[model samples]
Target: MLTPEFSITQDDDFIFICIKIAAIRFSAANLEMLVDENLFIFHLSPYYLRLRFTQHLVDDERSNAEFKSQDETIRIRIPKATKGEFFDDLDLPTKLLARKGDILGADAVKAPSKSNAGPLIQEIDTPGENGNLEQAGEDFNWEISQTPMPPSDATRLLTSKYGFDDNYSSVIGVSIANGNDINELDDPEKSNAEDRVQERLRKENLKFDPEYYVSEYMTAKYGNEDDIQINGIKSLLKFTPPLVKKFLKWYKQADDKEAVMSVEFTEVEQQQMQKNLPKKTYLVDDVKKLYITMLSLLFAYMYEQVENEGVHNTESAWTIGKLAPQLSFLDQQVITESAASELSVIKAIVLTGIRRSLSYPLHRNFDLSIKVWNYVYYTLRGGKRLVIQALLDLHEVFRFHDVYYVYNTVLISDLCAWFIIAGNENIIRSLAIELKKELDQVTKKDIDFDCVCGIDESSGEVSWENMNIEEMEILSEQEYLQQSGRPA
Candidate 1:
């Protein structure tokens, strides 16, 4: 049976659901709906939809169903089990469709406290210094950092056998293999220099359709982005999988949190990942944390791809390969080891993660996303720690099922499949739950007016120190002379 297009809305006392089936008419028969506790089942010959909700619904004297022949839509209204009880995640349609599953067990427990006071950032310990570092924070600290380790000989043999050791450099036109300099890779936007002109023109000439933007991108029926975010987080608290719950419980009982984040996948898990994931030798210092970073990056990229390009298809796969450089900033060759907590790496994650999480799966307004980014930047003033906290939380969620191979068998596969496959969009809803939680919490801070805005600190005025050179129309003679004095 086909799942028809649907929309959900709610008031204080009643929950409203409208399902649109193109074939339905006034004469249609066998239309049935069964409300069993929180699960609602609907069947109409060729159409079927089963939704598992967070709150209970009852069909009684106040319940009603109507069929509109003019629009061929079925509208159902059910009273809330308890008056004034709010239903969360009504905006997350795909998540509502999740099948009934086992409840989380007692093994699930709370994560470690993030309220400790101190520097929010840490780096690898240097000689003559204790492992302690200090910064300007009351007691909070950014996420922990770990450098990527070199590939072992056994791993190198596997990559060579799999013919993926080149590390996808051909697509991005840069090599970051072991021992190569990332600085030599150039800007991510200019990865493929041969097609730079065409890509720039494509970006510059794109047109915006107001109607599509409003109806599809903005999702007016889902209310606003803030509502969507809050609802998503509330759902995470209610609907996380059994494995995730158990993992949380196990983490709470662990003695060494850092060891949990650094665990390696088993050999069997490696074989499973080799089938689908890229087989190249990965340079990872902390395996779990690195995957967590990729998880955030890929989740963000998938949402943006869906909103901008419409849906997953053949083109989407190519898009992933083509834009791989911009997504992770790693190249084909690698000379130096890199850490997840490096300012540059963390900065890229923040820029991409903030923009995508705040804007996609609903509102796609460019201006609004930027405003949200600015609000987040100055609020917590701890983007690094905020992101790390989110990742750590997500890590616990992941460890429940595949503690040995969560990155290979679960996180990356689930996300990559959702990005390129059609029916797997449901996973996106659950991911949004974790992401929205972090975004909403940090955005609650009072705005910081002292935040820098590209002003020349010495002159106390707005400055063009980093203005776009291409858009520099008016220039002083001295500046022009200085430019002319430089060699091409």
Candidate 2:
């Protein structure tokens, strides 16, 4: 029997199951439903559906089943054994379809002992129904002679957990084993310049206040309550429907086989990137977790691009680089040759994405940021190739302007490592099937960045004394607090 498409939803009392049986007209007599404790059996001729639930359900007087002819749907409402009992994991349909043996932690079927068991087959003489007994004992050549099929792209991707392919050995792998000391060191002048750059970047990071940025943007946009504006704010801050459609269209075009497949890095750029790749190998216990971590950084980087209106400059790139370490605990992890679990890396990367795209972008509208992040997270489900293509496309956009090395060098290098390691696999698909049963598992409620990133939201409070007389009168502190919904 074929399993029909179905949906399950519940509140406090009744669990509603909507099963869609397209193009088939069925009456109440043709439909059959059996609810035995946790198991639900629905049979309608060719269609059969069996669902096992954690919570007990009963078909009492309150329970009802109806056939909606207009939509060709069968709606079954079963009352919970215990009324007002909130059922957990309803959103995860996979969990609800768990077998009895899976939930009970034991095999549902027990094999009978050999002593009590008997073979039903009597003899081989019963097999010759065509009167050709000679063929019964003859060996049948079931193995046909054929050329071995080549491994698929997906299969090839699983070759290395870290995506260290033969093609990327010179770029990703070290030239010599234990060659840290033997490697050429930078000149004193170059070292000094690097130090100066680091110092300047540190100062910039110290100066950046997430709250202040949001407050300033808010004051400028909505300082006067009489002239409050939200018309084109979505195009700027949020990922609207039009933006999503455009992004998806670009994604599909880039993913096409006919399209240019490579990122097309120059020989000089390749050498520079090779020099920057991590020299020492670091072990990741959970490969999927590491993949997700890499994806978060990519998402954050793209999000910044959207925020900058597709313009990539030195300033924004610098901000992203500094903010990456600040937002993520990747800086805190002890980087040694020894392998470490990917759990911390995963958490850090997720934290970084949340902080960068959602937390810091829209300071005043927490809900709006949350809503936008939802789009960002969901859009990432298209797979790793989509992201790589999008990054390549975004790089082209950046190249039109005075492109910054920090964006490619610092941010893209890390992304490249992760992408190369797991390039062959569909990360979004694996994330859903292996890591998380549902993509929506990472929700807005998971936006706990301040505690993780070590940011004191109240630390960089705008001082009233520093403001000019005209500026102070235009937007009062009380009004700002009221608009921002922040405590004084």
Candidate 3:
């Protein structure tokens, strides 16, 4: 065997390495030789080598023991090239021969005849391919496949492998593997399970009823629809059915409450009411409360008309003017006398009815609305003294400015107006004075009165140009004050 040797040296100034391979031999008589005694040189630069060996193959008897034995030698050389360009400068033959010899030296040489480079060959025999396979198979024990396990057994295997107990279904078993607890796995016995299950469920941060989670998700994402139905039986199994039943029951009860007062009022009545009353200027809560109170009173009035009077006058829709009088009478009868204890109860029921009407899903007739408003106004106004005294008694309850303002303004205004119309100037003046004092305190802070004065300079219509005596007086005073130089 002829051993291959290579020598390499670098010139520091040139940044190139000189590589040389020597003693390459070939039997010219027996082996085909492409080239002989060739000096392959490469020019290398700082960045790139002149020669690069992309692929190589070597045929050495020692490297391929199954091939015919032969002595072979290969040599390669490179001179005066930078390290980066050293390989680039080398010729192809030199690059190929050098890399091939390097590979042969690294690997144990085997005979060419025994090399695995030729045709495909099988190393193992199967019973179908060789009759001796049966003899070989006889050494190994084989038996009939065991009968398939029952679903229960399969479930047990899955649970055991995934660390789940009997309470956990297969889906929950998978979830447990993903860091969820078996207790979190939806189970039918969530409520009936031992306290330990509940505790475990709490620890696992699992909902007792999965449907609740789904419903919450649906409401948040899709909003409330008329009817919602869940799909998929397996998904359904993740929730306790009885818990769902309870939720459905509650939903139905709520639906019933909403249905009770959802009466629609006529458009004509709405138009008429809108024409009669000033445009509504109230806060959202106040508007809602007003609408609800009207609806409830309308409902009560309708009931009274139908049951007591045996009348079916839907045309006589409630109006603010109409209901106010009735409400005032009811208030006088209920609140002014020694039966004051019943006043709180009446107020509570009225407030509750108002709330229910507001939350009710449908609209009510405008006439009915007007009637209810009238009733509420009259009731408060008729029992003004009693109502004010009651407010004083429960001052804490009436502390909110919004509630107090509406109650005093609308309710008390109705009473004063009615009294004034009835030619009771004394009562009107007394109420007016009291209201004025309250108004003064309320308006103590500087206010933007432009809106109230209806002055629109932007329209180019100077209505104030023809000043009245009062206005001219004020203007003259202002001019005088400015000229007085007293810092007025």
Candidate 4:
């Protein structure tokens, strides 16, 4: 077997390395590159290529890796440690290869024991072979298969593998992974600076103040990046039946709170259109508290996705604080680039989560979703030119789900119109018109003609084909109230 051999060259600042690889067999996951201070270990599965430099090196964190499978080589452009020659000649003190060619579990590296036998094909035999195996007749040990582990030991082993550590703090309703400040939550004296944000949710008197809710989200900062929490959110998005049920329960409660709060505000007669557009207790309240807590936990991750673009404190970037108010400073074209792919992923998850949260009966998830939308709206609010961008993104996210029932029948009424009244009407109206064209096409196909005819025989209600069903359902609450001769 011919092991892949690479050539190395160095310039004033960077050391360029290239290797001849089997374009057919080589793949991205097949390669691993690790850099110690001066040594570079390149493991292409069973193939090992090591290079050591005399000069101490900066970490490869900033170095760029390029793979040209078509060219049958990988070029890793590494920054040199010194101003001159990076290596004496890419021939260093030690050159090593793996004794056991297994790449996955091969953490130990020992010199090859003068083996004429080459290459790796490895596996493990856990249970003894049975009738299916060729060796079962004489070589296999049947007793090994029959050996059962003790239930306690089995349970302990399973727990240890999963990294579960149950402790006393968990017993008293305090969680280690709770993600809240345990010190602040535990000691009321320490929490006196704020009233612990009153996360305990109740059915009565919902707290829907937008400013306070925004503050809640900003404060519950998840790290700029997280491997674990983001994965948990991704799991929930995989159409998990239980997650859907749980979110619906919280959303319905939030909806009820919105309904009740709307009524309360109705009685008081708030003047602004923005005030009428569904306000609510922060999602952190009650069951929403759990959902929003998860959302907050992921805010930093989403922020990091944008941050991964190497945004400095000076360079303008999108953040949760500005999401409700504005579109991203990074343009749509820029967002499609590699550095901004994470931003796009974040948007996809956000859009899907919101769409799933809404578009369900027995739940009012719009308020929670709108709080999320507020970020974009806030971004737009910061600059009027961004109105078109926000409108386009709104269309894109809604189009992503393609739930015309929600967009035509729900969003046009309250959500997008609220955007119009907030600032620029022309840009939003343009989106509404474009969306209306698309809605027209979808309405042609998805029209429920039987519903118009009152097909439900059990209800025994007559219907008219001439009824403006879509218009009525899509009417704003204020419009309905005005038409019915109720208070604004």
Highest TM-score: give the candidate number: 1
TM-score, candidate 2, is: 0.36
Model 4 ranges with Cα > 4 A deviation: 1-352, 355-488
Order the candidates by TM-score, highest first: 1, 2, 4, 3
Relative to the true structure, candidate 1 reaches a TM of: 0.37
How do all the candidates rank in terms of lDDT, highest first? 2, 1, 4, 3
TM-scores, one per candidate: 0.37, 0.36, 0.16, 0.19
Q: Whole-model Cα lDDT per candidate?
A: 0.39, 0.44, 0.26, 0.31
RMSD values for the candidates in order, in angstroms, are 19.4, 25.0, 44.2, 26.9
Q: What is candidate 3's local distance difference test score? A: 0.26
How far does residue 118 in candidate 1 sit from its true spot (Å)?
A: 16
Q: Model 1, stretches more than 4 Å misplaced?
A: 24-29, 100-488
Tens-digit lDDT track for model 2 on 244-271? 4554465456634212122333333333
Clash number by candidate, in order: 22, 2, 52, 18
TM-score of 3: 0.16
lDDT of 2 at 416: 49
